[model samples]
Target: MNPELKLVAARQGGVFSRAQAMAVGYTPEQIRERLTGGRWERIRHGQYAERADLSALDAWEQHIVRHRRAVHAAMNSMRPGSAVVSHHSALVLQGIPVWQVDLAEVQLTRTSGRGEVKAGVRHHQGRLSPADTTRVDGLTTTTIARAVVESAARTSFEAAVVSADAALRRPEVSAEDFRRLLAVTECWPGSPAIRSVLAFAVPLAESAGESRLRVLMRNEGLPPPVLQAAFNDAAGFVGRVDFYFPDHNTVVEFDGLKKYADGSREALIREKLREDRLRALGLEVVRVTWADLLQPARTATHIRQAFDRARRTRLAG
Candidate 1:
């Protein structure tokens, strides 16, 4: 790998923007020819990554590179307000799965000018400061902490918390850094998201899906569920539930497509058998998918209804 490619790999597989290319000694024509010859891939406008190992360009890697390049290009061409990447761009840089998107947009602070800056790119105006910002791949971005807050702000309360917890659990980010980042957001617009994230994003950092469901439940004012609660029976360890409420005997399972994309029938069958065994243990299990995450209100309602039914069964027994 060349020095540039090495740098990109260090950045978790980033792509180069046109401005980045110019800074690194590649002209627009050279970039174009690289794309034409399949030497480089155009992930988004003015963004290019090497096709040296196309297989390595998984969806997450490709999306992060494209977003990074887009943010860099936008910042280079921006006026009035300096663009500091936020939301999905920040999550991508932090290697979190908050918003899965291919396009990248430069999120500007409130001081940005009113006119439209670019096509196919989004500009988010918010309160920001120098302390909560960093430079990556030649683009300004909200620090990992700020990005976690922004990601949570865009999500239901619990989802945000889970993402924040995950961000903090990463060795690159520390609890102290998260607090410092939160302190700076005191004057930031949408501080509710920041505060809520700070309060709930903790405590369940080890459980991926629990906090997301908890946030949704909290948004609906439902009682918080237990995390990693296990059930035992004569048939050995039944299974582990992502979120469980002992009183209601209800469970929530978060599923990511990557888990099953391997296409193993035996694995799939084993998973199903586990679910069946859990159901047989008199647990009312609810499956939460990515789509349900997008519709949190309905998901919360569904879970609440399941709890009601489980309560009735428990009372009868």
Candidate 2:
């Protein structure tokens, strides 16, 4: 690869157009040879990326990386300022994690044209005022608030809440920002769902797993638990819990892989000790993992059993 072309590709998320390769002293035949040799992979029509970059990512991460490169490719091929990245695509560019949202097609909002889907790109025809649009990674994109609302309008409630919760955690985004966008889009389709997401989204959620767990609790008819509640004992600060059910005297902790990413025995022992201390305070503890979230009914039953145990212990005391 030419040095100039590598620079260009680096600036565009490791994607380069065919014309860019040609300008960087590569012939059409050579480009084809590189693609065939697996040195370069095609992202979209006439868009190519280094095979090494794609192969370096894990399967799940590769999807997002490919979609991001595709977004850059799609935007580069379009007329400048003609459209802004919107919806899930905008969230992607803004670096907010999305859950269960389709990324097969890059979504854009045309400033002045009818909506259409062409070549894996979905052009949305909607009003995008200056206030609602911003630049992200050198590409024009919808503001985080608008992206969240637009995304909520089109995706499942769980997916929407995940993105919304993540967005609210950003310093640039606030609950008020979402509310303002919600007010403006009140009559828009899926406004009711967006409203529900706004009402439920909290900044304290630190991971997508936690957000999904919250949605599951709501859908399973569990009473709302306090978020990130702090616990302490006479020794010192115990730890902050993910969810605390005050009335039930139980605490639910989301056990995602990141919690134990180090795979250290000492870390596990520390966590066990923390649970012991919480139990010493007469608080029943329940653990929720990604797998447990998948089995919502069983998870709810387990939580209920913990609540019953706490009640029984109190009675015995």
TM-score, every prediction: 0.68, 0.96
Q: Write down the worst ten-residue block by lDDT for model 2.
A: 52-61
Q: Pick the candidate with the highest lDDT.
A: 2
Cα shift from native, residue 79, model 1 (Å): 13
Model 2, 15-92: lDDT tens per residue?
A: 899999999899999999999999999889899999855576667687887789889999888888888899999998
Q: Candidate 1 local accuracy as lDDT?
A: 0.68
Residue 241 of model 1: what lDDT? 72
Instruction: Tell me how far candidate 2 lies from the true structure as C-alpha RMSD in angstroms.
Output: 1.3
C-alpha RMSD for every candidate: 5.2, 1.3
Please report the candidate that would top TM-score against the real structure. 2
What's the TM for model 2? 0.96
